[model samples]
Target chain A: AQSVTQLDSQVPVFEEAPVELRCNYSSSVSVYLFWYVQYPNQGLQLLLKYLSGSTLVKGINGFEAEFNKSQTSFHLRKPSVHISDTAEYFCAVQGSNYKLTFGKGTLLTVNP
Target chain B: GAGVSQSPSNKVTEKGKDVELRCDPISGHTALYWYRQSLGQGLEFLIYFQGNSAPDKSGLPSDRFSAERTGGSVSTLTIQRTQQEDSAVYLCASSLGGPSGGYTFGSGTRLTVV
Candidate 1:
């Protein structure tokens, strides 16, 4: 079985400052990693995914995440954050069986 | 549909009242999934329907929870004898399936069992 662990439950950052939300996973086989963001009362939107290319994957709204095979980590990073970027972020891992397991999610609150 | 559509954006039901949530996937999409999101929790996989394959019911938390996708387009999740613990946001998502694209999610139906 595959599982994800989001190290932080909430992260507060000032506008225009950098932020990183940590995520880690555990699986015996190869996996595909994904990041999703959900605004209040809204559905989740895919931020980025790491399939089989470069470790660095970029996605919508100036967000990016790096896949680390050895560390079993895929942490999301934003060079500069905006107030609108505040949302709940989830990290997921799809195993060979095609079951997507998600972490507990990290709430990003960007303050002015 | 242009995007995944879930009806009854919010529902409040008394305990023991059964409720059915609907989900309409984008046109031509083959895979649909159901998930539950409780307060302060992440997405919990509930069920999955992929093409003509048998649905994966491994994630259903209990026998009271069940889902069905008819005509390969619309899905209905039914929670019988609903309990307070069943109160949460039920989300639906669809994808092309098979490692091709990211899933498109609906706004979800926030269910409150009082």
Candidate 2:
């Protein structure tokens, strides 16, 4: 079975500061990685995804994640964040069966 | 039509009662999934339906949880004798039916069991 681990339950950062949300997965075979953001009371929206090719994948809202095959990690990063960026982020992995295994989400609180 | 639609944005029920949640996936989507999100917890896979294949119930937490997708377009998740632990947001998603496809999720139905 596949699983995702999000190291941080919550991350606090000031506006205009950079942020990184850590994620690790356990899978025996190749997998697709994704980062999704959810605003209060809203559905999840794709921030970025690493399907194939480049290890560095850019996504919406100036967010990016690197798929490290060696470490089995897909960490999401943003050079700078705004108060509006405050939301819950989830890291998910898709195995060969197309089922997505999600991490326990990290709440990003961007303070003004 | 444009996005996955779930009914009864919020539902409140008493213990021992049965509740049903509905999901209308995007038109033409062959794959639909149901997931449960407890407070302060990650999304938990409940059930999956792909085309005409037998649904995957491996992730269901208990026998009290049951789900069905009809015509390969709509799905319903029913909880029998709901318990306090059953209170959570139930999310529905759909995709093009492949390992490489990204899913579009609904706002979710919040079920509160009293």
Candidate 3:
């Protein structure tokens, strides 16, 4: 079974500041990792994913994440954040069984 | 549709009533998924459908929670005798089937069981 853990429940940042949302996963087998963002009442939007190859993955909206196999972590980072970046972020893992296990989520609150 | 579409953007129903939520995946996308988001508890996987094979229903919480995909395109999630616990944002997503491509999500149905 695969499980995901998002380190923070809420993160408050000033606009244009850099931020990182921590995520870690536990799985016995190789798995795929993903990061998604949810704004207000909207559904989740894929921010990025890590399937194979490079450890660092870049995603939409200037967001990026690094997949550290040894540490079992896939942390998301953004150089500069905007007020529009304030949203709920989630980390997910998909194992061979093909089921996506999501973390509780981290709410990003960017203030101007 | 250009993206996954979920009907009944918001639903308010009395406890014990049955409710049905619909999802239309993007055309040609073989994999469909259902998830529920509650207040503090994050998104919970409910079920998955891929092509003509059987669906992975291991995530279904209980017998009251059931879903069906017809002709391998549209899916309907039926919750029999809904409870307050069932009140949440039910999200639907579709993918190309596998790890190669991530999933595309719909706005979701906000179900409020009174």
lDDT of candidate 2 over A1-112, digit per residue (tens): 7899999999999999999999999998889999999999998898989999999999999999999999999999999999999999999999889999999999999998
Q: What are the per-residue Cα lDDT tens digits for candidate 1 across A1-111?
A: 999999999999999999999999999889999999999999999899999979999999999999999999999999999999989999999986566788999999999
Model 1 ranges off by over 4 Å: none
TM-score of each: 0.98, 0.98, 0.98
Per-residue error (Å), model 2, residue B11: 0.2
Per-residue lDDT over B1-114 for candidate 3, one digit per residue giving the tens place of the 0 to 100 score: 899999999999999999999999999999999999999999999999989989999989999999999999999999999999999999999999987788899999999999
Q: Tell me the TM-score of chain B in each candidate.
A: 0.98, 0.97, 0.98
Between 1 and 2, whose lDDT is larger? 2
lDDT of each: 0.93, 0.94, 0.95
TM-score for chain A, prediction 2: 0.99
Task: Tell me the spans in candidate 2 whose CA falls farther than 4 Å from its real position.
Answer: none
Lowest lDDT sum, 10 consecutive residues, model 3 chain A, at: A93-102
Residue A100 lDDT, candidate 2, scale 0-100: 94
- lDDT by residue (B61-109, candidate 2, tens digit) is 9999999988888899999999999999999999999756599999999
Instruction: Give the winner by DockQ: 1 or 3.
Output: 3
